[model samples]
Target chain A: MGLHMKRWTVNPETWGAVVSILGFVLLWYILTAVLKLPRFDKLPNPVAVFSAWLSPHPQFGLSIFTRGYYLDILYSVGRVLAAFVLATVLGVGLGLLMGWSRVFFDYSFPLVETLRPIPPIAWIPLAVLVLPTAELGVIFITFIAAFFATVLNTLLGVRSIDEVYFRAASCLGSRPRDVFWNVVVPGALPAIFTGLQVAMGIAWISLVAGEMIAGQRGLGYLIYEDYSNLQFVNIVIGMATLGLLGYGSSALVRMLGRRLMAWEGRRRGGAMA
Target chain B: MSAGGALSIRQVTKVYDPEGVHVVAVDNCSLEVASGEFLVVVGPSGCGKTTLLNVIAGFEELSEGEIRLDEGPLALPGKQVGPGAERIVVFQNGALFPWKTVLENIAYGPVVQRRMAKNEAQRSARELLRQVGLEGIEESYPAELSSGVQRRVEILRALINEPRVVLLDEPFRGLDAVAKSVMHQFLLDMFERTRCTMYFITHDLDEAIFLADRVVVMTTRPARVKLELSIDLPRPRDHRVLGTERFLKLKQAALEAVHEEALKAFQAGERELA
Candidate 1:
């Protein structure tokens, strides 16, 4: 708690970022109001947008934000959640397999190399054509984006491990599987996290693109619909939600990583000192 | 911890990258280490001293021949390694797990071997920490300790398992003079208490003379035992031994044996460049 307080007070970066976020809001307000661009005819002013955001569905006597927007937000979150989970399972599992054995590495390398260069957005056309459902296409695109980076990062993590660790573990009477599970996995986790973080960002980008193309629901679909109808305020709201969702989810991951690798943090801090 | 096992390494030849210009590491090496003997193998760097130690520790595959403990093969034929607390190798780097505390690091051997329950391992770990003069710092991470303390922890980690034979591979490479001296004393004290057989590899002639009951000098890669001198020095030796006549004499002899090897090692490297 003291550390948090100290950080809050003394950390220029933290305060700077917060200030910049508010600055962006002010700038956004000025751009629409004071500047009064020709585009303002359809694009509602900040006050109107904020009011719309605040009361998106005022007919039911409840706040529109709390009711209608909540569902859209939930729908967006659900799609990301499903996609992220699928990406993680496929990524980590295949990554482990690729890392552990030479045969798997060789077998997967060519195919992975081919797939990785093509952006997940590029898969939208193929996914739409090949997959039966739009949701499946979105998920496939997210998975493709996440899976390759995870596998590659995991492989690199495994390769970079000190040979002595394996020798030491073996001499300590640890079995092959024990060595892999106990030493290799934990040792490689930091790098794996790097992959996961990148994969998550890519997954978000992919989901957005997929939804824009063919989505029936989700934040991306909502954004696209708002854009075509010139519902500028709603579009801004959708983008803000997406930004918050992506960043918030990533921060949660970082927190989980810290808890899981409490020891690693200590080690790194010591080494730095 | 009393004198227990005799280690006999016979015709042990280690060649790296065999089938493609194999570089011999230990050439037809044969040696007998009596139970509880503290033998230090001294040579110039690149003389395969560490390779010989690794072969004994079962971390390296010997091109030919065998290592036996108590007349039975320690490392099986056509196989690289064998079993038991007969051998434990301490690397040049302390190689402590940065993640584990001093207590946990020392407890690794017991936990790995399943010799003690987790709670029992903690108890044993505390005892080992105390023995190594790190009792108060048991909760401290390996990264938190000084180099001297870290080195002590490494020794304690190795000794925690009570291995019959312990291999020291340039164990004091990074330590300052005072830290090295402390480690020397600690090692001597542990040896006296345990009477476990030891094989220490060092490029430091003084360290070799300072600790070993016997000093085996080696030549450069395709390394062979050039000379083996019995130290017959008084036990529980102190730092004052370094100034003593007998200690200086032993140091001189160890240096002489490796003097030509040092030159040859350098020359061979130059030749490779040419």
Candidate 2:
């Protein structure tokens, strides 16, 4: 009982999420049973839903991963990785320029502001027509989705560095490049990492939307196809899988952030002030 | 320039915004630090005592006049202080870089300006740590240690450069009485051994008298030297010196010169607020 309680209790926030999810499951079950609603054949009962998730594909047997559902998951992850890497590099580079120099801010600020407010998905048709191929179009949308957020965050982080640090470095005879490389970069690192984390989430959001429109293989495409076929169980599986993958990737970014800003963690915990 | 000069400030004045609403911070402040002398400069706030030090250190360009080391015009402060012309400054807040270990803090100057081999610098760093009574705490970060230990690491950092002049800017301001007393003696002993030209600044009359060989008193902003008193007390001076007649006389004289300026500084602050 104690072991069960310990596992169930967890954090209050996590417990609330678990309870709400159970409430949703019960609500669906009651509508089908107590209300005597006409059940669609494609939409399985809760028991059937769980059974379909657990049981191996009888037709494909051991090669069940070859099914369209898993293939879509792989494609979506690949697209996300590609777009995230592109955003990280370009965002950090532009951020450094914007953060370090007034000249760069003056030259680039207006153009960035003009482009940034338009939604990444709005660029989809333009990307489709402009790019030679569909995959490139999807990648362009995802990159745009991530880049603007990353650049803005990076610029703020770089600008927030204490001016006293610069004065101190100058007093110690640090050259301009030396100041840029050693003082500014390290000082801005925690903020840059924060920007990258935000970019990753936005990259996933934009990538899936793009993939639904443009790609045949990704999880987003799989969900849309299942919905069109009236395969509600498969659609539920696809949605759940997307949630799990997004959560896992975000956790990975946060883990890397912890390692990078270990000092900040200590400061937060009252280990040092 | 006529004094047995290691550093000479010749009629140096620092003016802020000279073209518009000019405020002179330090006014024609001519001073000299003889080699191995322990000089203390004391005044109320806004006296430009720090600005005066910065000008000599080459951190600020003087509005007029010049600073010389060994009777030659010194290089600008932001230039890496030259070899054999080293000037180490201990900032008010112990300014030990939080990111570095105590050992690394001490070795920073040698690694950057002195260009000493890493192993050699580490060796000297450990030695200076011992001199500052911080042996065996070398690997700790400044934030991990107490304020007293952090200040000792800062002193070790300054000394590792083997500076001709070591500038202490209110180094004892944050310490408790026991910590300050311990630091005061440790500094005097360390200076006796190394004999660096030390210029210590404080508003505290007792601290100025306890540490300095000669005390230079200053008026409030538009600051100029009010008086210079030579400390005639014998070496290895102790807690007993605080109770002695000679020490009392010296402290009394220093306070008398600075009292009017202290009041003027307060009134000027009020006028600004009004």
Candidate 3:
């Protein structure tokens, strides 16, 4: 609610973070705004970008006051949401089957290993050829990144459990289904969440690259358009907004993870695996 | 809580032939544990005491022979019945669920398999905790507790199941000396209160003599019973009993029996390596 309330006034401890952020901006201001060095003269200074970010009436017709800015944001967010949800459902389901059943692991894991290494952007040309719409192709790129991360991490989570727990559960008379739900599910959840955090970051990165190459309407597309039209300040604004959105999405994932795994916060070791 | 169960093991044999390694873990071993008796088995490291416990606990199938639990066939000639609620094992490393609260872990077995209501199981769990004077920390997770407390909670978790037999496989292997003695008293108190059949396995001869009514020593590998010595220590015994002449004599007998197997195991291991 309050990134806007006060500009770094309350806490002494948090001043370090404020200083770090301000220092980066100061270096950029010196490089371009003051010194106007060789390559720096071509790029927009932070002062120009900062004012453009706050301007209701930006010189380039896009800013905090512009409706087109939000429309671009909404498109990117919508695509990420659709892709992220599908990736989670597919990845976690596949991971559980692979982790629990020997037959499934033997049959599918080799193929998974074959496919996992291809970068998401590598799929752009094939996805565009196969998918009906460019938007779908961009989403496919995002989904691929998130799906691999989630599946691999969830599998590791399930495998990291101690074998004694399984023995103990069965000795306590748990049926196979009971052991699956009581032991495997809870034991793997912490690692699954770790995967989700990594997935969120990758999903956003892929979304931007996919938009630049294949998308027509999103923050990624806006950056490409700004560059083509020589609206350099607007391009920086697009990149900054995308960064903020990605950070926000990761924070949301972490919040959900914390609520689900409230017991995890109490471990004396003080780190989530 | 006093539903003691007698276990009869007859000509039991276990062979591990994975990838043609052809290792026999337990060979033609036969023993009977009377109902309510505290029986401790001592052997050299890697001498397969744990394999014997695993057989009785129904985690492993007998390659030959059978085990009976109170007249019921536990592991028979052909059928392999998996582990059940009637036999519970307290593992060497603590196995309490790190995710569940102390009370929730204690209540899990009864609530899951026994079909007790959740509230009813919790009530019994609290009562068990109160008996151990760990009353206020019922809501704490296992990771939040000290190792000593975690082991105590694990034992309470097993005891709450009211299993006919409780197995301990080197359960005190990693505790410090001070913690080990306190755990000794704690275990004895629980045993006296429950009177459940106990099948404990350890490499420590002193622990065996301290806790068991009878101690069985096994030979090095392809382990078979080498000697069985009765511990004549009185019931409700304490640390002072460790200083008595009778305890020392019993310890001496066990040490002598185990020392020979330890040496044989060393020689066998050396030959395998050489």
Candidate 4:
């Protein structure tokens, strides 16, 4: 009887999440299909969107089984991955240097602070004019969006490391290089991962916007093109696909973060238990 | 190993100037620890005992006089030396790397110093863990361990370096009575095995009496060394010594010295509040 009771006691967090997602979908369906609200009139219903996604040779000239759909996904995913990786490397490197050395921080901080608050979209015209290709320009915009978030967070992370750790490292006879690798990197990791998660979100947002404005092949372009043609179902398909892809990529980043920061996870788990 | 571990502090003073207001932390603190000596400094809260420790550790600059380690000029006023492996400190809170496991934390000192290979460091870390009665939790992170276990791991992290001098800043401050007592015993045992000259600071009189061969009591801020009492307790002492007449005598003496300073600090705090 105790075992049965234990098994039945599901985690409230999990149940809450399941219920919220289902309710959201149900509400969306009701507002569009049943209530037939004026605002949601043009918005494609869940059934039309899902069926369009599954149908071979749908209005967007792509479906789940089609090569064109996969190609669009590949284009979007590839751009985001490239831009995200580039931003991570550059951001972490610059942030660590700025954090570690007062001289470096003094020199760079003014420029970074001036540039950081400017939105990535505002740089589109400048990037397009300056860069060699439109693809590079789009990637540059995506990179900028992710880069600032990562750099600022990584810098904050490094600065936030307790002074005690630095003193302890010094007493342990850690060389400058050893201190950077051992103390600065790992100490800044939690904040860096937080930065990465935020950066991933920004990366997808910028990538989609950049694609819609400039490009020809991604899910963003599909949405734009389908809207122009008044294939409303394909636009919903593109929107849903983009949402899933963004979620999946962010989840991947989160999963990697959990794996790398197992110590932090254990500490939180211990606290909860 | 204990030949040249002497630390000589001669009229060392630290002054902090915040917006042209001069606040002296350590006032002409002159003391010495001989090779293989266990010296504990006891003082009231805000007595600048930690400032003295930081000065010895080379983390803070001395405003007056100098400190010498092993008969060599270690740090002078206005030109502070950085912390070195020779004088490792075990802080009040065990500042173990939260990311690293117990074994990795212990191995950190040697690996960073390039004194031992990674595998060799890990091997010796395991041995040290066993000696400290922390055998099975080698792979545990600092947060995963109990406060007692974390303190033990921190001690090994310092000891594994086999530093010339070990400075402890209230190393067992936040533990339960049982855990604190166990740690006291564990520290004593480690001292026996490795006679690393130790400079320990604590506010707890009983802890000072239990741990120190000699205890230095400091006055309230602008702290100065008020009294130094030597303990003649037998070697291999344990919790039983806490109840001994000699131990009680030492504790009473240290407490009296500390209580006067504490009262002065309390009155000063009241004045500030007023």
Candidate 5:
């Protein structure tokens, strides 16, 4: 255990990641600032973007110092979180029902199949028209992509679970509800988590697309506004923020999955040990 | 000692129709497992022995027949009874719920069935773990354990349910010879302690002879009872008995019966493939 800790403490992986990022940043600096590449020169350099982002009182209307900047982030985050939660609930529930019952699958599968192929962005115009508010429309658009991803993944997760687990559960005196709670749910968890990660990614994509088209607020709208205004530096900031937020949300989901499925990690470790 | 219920499998027939092709899996197979008896069923691979086990476990409703636990109805041709705790089946491929810890897997039945409180389950589960010599490893997941240990845990899982009949469908099919013998001893010890009705299915003749109170030799596909042999081996038997003349005699008899069925199954395989 001590050796393991020591090896990790002086981990090469951290250095490798650091080196890669540093190398990328250096290359970016060289291209725009040093080499003066044609199109690259027009874009804000990484340093300028970082400096502008870090500045409390920046020339750009959006920056770390401004309330507007944080509000945009908060709004975008809120929309994604809300949409993700709803998608998760509906998708997982619908998926499980579809997986567990033949009747449910028969009745609702076609409806899901029809709606599933429609991209989340495709709902933007309809969501704006149908929903009372642009905010609701944007959230709905975000939800659509995530909901489908979660539903499809959750359904596949349920379907992919081995029949042996079902047999074992039944043989163990599990009632129908008991089987669902114990066998079907846990068996599908790994797959469900995979679906959640995918859904979270798509949620961000659709959220950005929806905001660009429909909304007056959020990081997505900020980027579009920056592009229209041609405050290229602010555009970089917006893009960077969206990237970090998307990565962070996916990482959070992964962390939660690991916490819940502690057994999975231990099992792998024990097998190797 | 006889907490186990008597299992009556009367005129059980199972037919599989995949893509409109009728395949008879179990043809009017009737079996009786007396209360607390260690009944081992041996036959060629794919000889409907497992189908028989599944029918008894109520995973499938028989095409034609009935099964019972003591006097309680288990499976009728047109009726779906259960895949219940009374007939816990340890599968050929281990089914110890990988998502759960070893203790959680063993404690599943009573807790899920609401028969025992959480803490009560923990205490008894610990006791079961100790019997399997897997003490202090309750927190480990199913994947962490060796296959031998996993199989042992699976048996403990069934026993913890305190089922009337424990049906094992080739529970030790993949174990090495040494591991298998160790498992056999472990199982014999468990059987002695529990005295639960054991309906063990295996293709191995030696396993049959070593474990059975009575061994039932089953015919090829659409399985039926071809021969029945009572193993009058003394209690608390171990590896030493494997070399005995009586053991050899019983082995030979079972071999002759199973060998014939195996040949027929092989020929059937050839015909199908061609």
Candidate 6:
């Protein structure tokens, strides 16, 4: 009976994910290849797209085997990584200070509050004009997209720490600096990670949008270029690649969160009856 | 009063205003504690027992009067000193840092103060853990331990700093009966060994009688001292002492004092509601 319950409970989630993905693909194939609806007919079939991707010298002037394709991937990944890292460091530092010191919060919070609501995409024209180069503009847009989420969430995290913890730290003879490091930082970490995950997603979105609007190369640029050239198969491949890379980078953030928050996981697990 | 841990609280008062509703929490409370003395404060709930502790710990400002440590004026009305390593409070809820392991929590005070190197702190923490009979749980987080174990760890965390005075705010309030009894014995043992001056606040008369060298009972809200009783119970006190005639007499007297204050507070609450 226990074994039967285990079997029923464990595999359903795994099976559900697998089945849903397969079913989605099958439906895509049926619409494009089998039924051949008007809009679907205009789009490339799954087989055509896969075959194009597999080709030695693909139609869109790149493939997995091509150095150009790798470069496109590299450009996108590097931009995201650099922007995300910059956003995280700045966001956390500013957030901690803003949360811990009333004077700092009073001085900066109004400016942050005013700017945070303005969408990262909305800054594109201004960024392009102000920044020295188009690449820097794109990076700035991506950085802004991630930075606000991290900063706000990290500030909230620091504020949310119980008052008693501060009392405990002070009573333990923690200097102001030590309190920031030992109590404020660790206390705010779980929330900061939540911010990082969100920031990672937003960074990708802004990067893609920025790339599509500006010149040069990235997965986003590849997709837009293919669409303009009417290479429908390459567009599909580019879309697929973007989806996979977004999922991969988000997964990396989640993995790091899990490693850092092992203690929290154990604590929460123990709390449950 | 003993030599090292002399603390004098002279006519201290604390008042608060919540949404412009004036409330007096502590009223003209005065007390003194000697070095290595185990002094317990007993009172009815909402009788400002905790407020008194908070005032003494320098976590809250006094509205009147002064507090002196070793005959040196420590804090005064409207200008309070912040919490420091010389005095640490062990909260009832075992406010152990959920993120740190037991060893880290115990070692935090010394390491943060730069009084000891990290390795030395760890070594001292290990010794403390052994003394407290919590030897193997150093690597475990507070959440992984039982509530009883957590309380023990909290005490160790406070004591590791060798604070001049340890303030315990009903430190065994939520434990099971068995766990509470064990903690009582453990606390007795610890007090015997270290002889650190402690100012313990509790609503439990039995607990006050069991642990205190002297017990101070406080009156209802806007609290002040109602009674003071010294327990001359023999040392190495254990479970066997609970049934003694002298212990029973002390418990009965404390209960009477607390019950009177509790009744007054209850009637005052009823009057306010009406």
User: Where in model 3 is the C-alpha error above 4 Å?
Assistant: A1-16, A122-135, A269-273
Ranking by lDDT: 5, 3, 4, 6, 1, 2
Clashes of 2: 2
Q: What TM-score, over all chains together, does every model reach?
A: 0.89, 0.83, 0.93, 0.95, 0.93, 0.93
Instruction: Report the lDDT tens digits of candidate 1 across residue range B74-173.
Output: 6644686643445777778877766567787778777778788767988988977776656788778777778888878888777878888888898999
Interface RMSD of 4: 2.4
Query: What is the C-alpha local distance difference test score of each model?
Result: 0.79, 0.77, 0.89, 0.89, 0.90, 0.88
Which pairs clash inside model 4? none
DockQ of each: 0.35, 0.23, 0.50, 0.63, 0.62, 0.55
Ordering by DockQ: 4, 5, 6, 3, 1, 2
Give me the runs in candidate 6 sitting further than 4 Å from their true place.
A1-16, A57-62, A269-273, B1-4
Please give me the DockQ of candidate 6 compared with the native complex. 0.55
- lDDT, model 4, position A199: 97
Deviating ranges (above 4 Å) for candidate 5 = A1-12, A271-273
| Chain B structural similarity (TM-score) per candidate | 0.95, 0.92, 0.97, 0.97, 0.96, 0.96
Measured with C-alpha atoms, the lDDT of residue B207 in candidate 6 is 84
lDDT tens readout by residue for model 4, A1-273: 555444566689889978987898899899999999998977888887777789876765667978978888999999999999999999999999999999999999999999988888888999999998998988998999899999999999999999999999999999999889888999999999999999999998999889888876898888888778898888777887888888889989999999999999999899421
Task: Please say which candidate is ahead in lDDT: 1 or 2.
Answer: 1
Tell me the tens digit of each residue's lDDT in model 3 across A1-273.
Answer: 755666645576568767977898899899998999999999999989989989988999889899999999999999999999988999988887788888999998999999999999999999999999998999999999999999988888899888898998999889889888888888899999999999989999999999999998899999999989999999999988987898789989999988888788778456321
Task: Compose the digit string of candidate 1's lDDT tens values, residues A1-273.
Answer: 555444425478888988999898788778778887777545566676667667757432223446546776676677777877887788887887788889998999899899889988888888889999887888888778877877888788887777776666666666678678867787788888888888888878888888888787778888888788877677877777789889998888888888787777776677521
Q: Provide the lDDT at B64 for model 4.
A: 92
* Better candidate by DockQ, 2 or 6: 6
Better DockQ candidate (2, 4): 4
List candidate 2 segments past 4 Å from native: A1-52, A55-67, A227-236, A267-273, B1-5, B75-85, B130-133
Q: List the residue pairs that clash in candidate 5.
A: none
Candidate 4 structure, TM-score to reference: 0.95
| Reference interface contacts recovered per candidate | 0.22, 0.03, 0.67, 0.82, 0.80, 0.77
In lDDT terms, how accurate is model 1? 0.79
